[model samples]
Target: MAKERSIPAPMANPETEPFWAAAREGRFLIKRCTACGKAHWYPRACCPHCMSEATEWVESPGRGTIYSLSVMKRAPEVYAVAYVTLEEGPTMMTNIVECDYDSLAIGQAVQIAWRPTAEGGPPYPVFKPR
Candidate 1:
């Protein structure tokens, strides 16, 4: 059987194209608001906090703590999805890798890692124990 493809392609948009481009180059980014000194994720055109349109893309520290997680045991094989709260204040949904499924726990420290795709899309960011 062939491996499943998971990477996502870049979306051509004025607000988020740069983000995808950078990710393709093996970088992770988060949106930071200059006016309000706040950071956000999912790449928005404006700051959700202060409603400021002045925002810039900044590289994430890529370090976070696992806020929550769930383990899968069925047809999908074994996998874990976690809500990681980044040190910089953004929570992202990512898969936890390089660790045993039974060893995962809430509040565990993890770091971002990239998973390249054969389909030529932007690398998917997953987490591993720090």
Candidate 2:
């Protein structure tokens, strides 16, 4: 039996509200440091690269390659988790959805897919084979 995966709602704070907002709007966003011209995941106020406060949100193309992955078949629901390297240069830990877990591979191309929170909060980004 294929059980549905339960997605937990992500908590939002002052630092991450905009990111959740954009996700609700069906857009993917990442933080980029103006000081060092580097993009990063898990958006923050200060640039992780240069330690600069000049950071801004940018819409991502919502496409990436799988850096690594693991499929958990023994869980309550079968699901795949992966580290995806975004075209913008940041690798994010995310769920791989809408595909056969056994067929997933490293370096597989993917695009953004959304799953609504179990509590009806903002939807979070997942990925499907592109």
lDDT of each: 0.84, 0.92
lDDT for model 2, on a 0 to 1 scale? 0.92
lDDT of 1 by residue, 1-130 (tens): 2223365555558787887788788788899999999999879888999999999999986999999999776654667889999999989898888887799999999998888765577777889998
Pairs with steric clashes in candidate 1: none
Writing each residue's lDDT as its tens digit, candidate 2 over 1-130 gives 5676877898899989999999989999999999999999988999988899999999998999999999988656888889999999999999998898889999999999998997889999999999
Query: Candidate 1's C-alpha lDDT?
Result: 0.84
The list of candidate 2 runs beyond 4 A from truth reads none
List TM-scores for all candidates, in order: 0.87, 0.95
Give the lDDT of residue 121 in candidate 1: 72
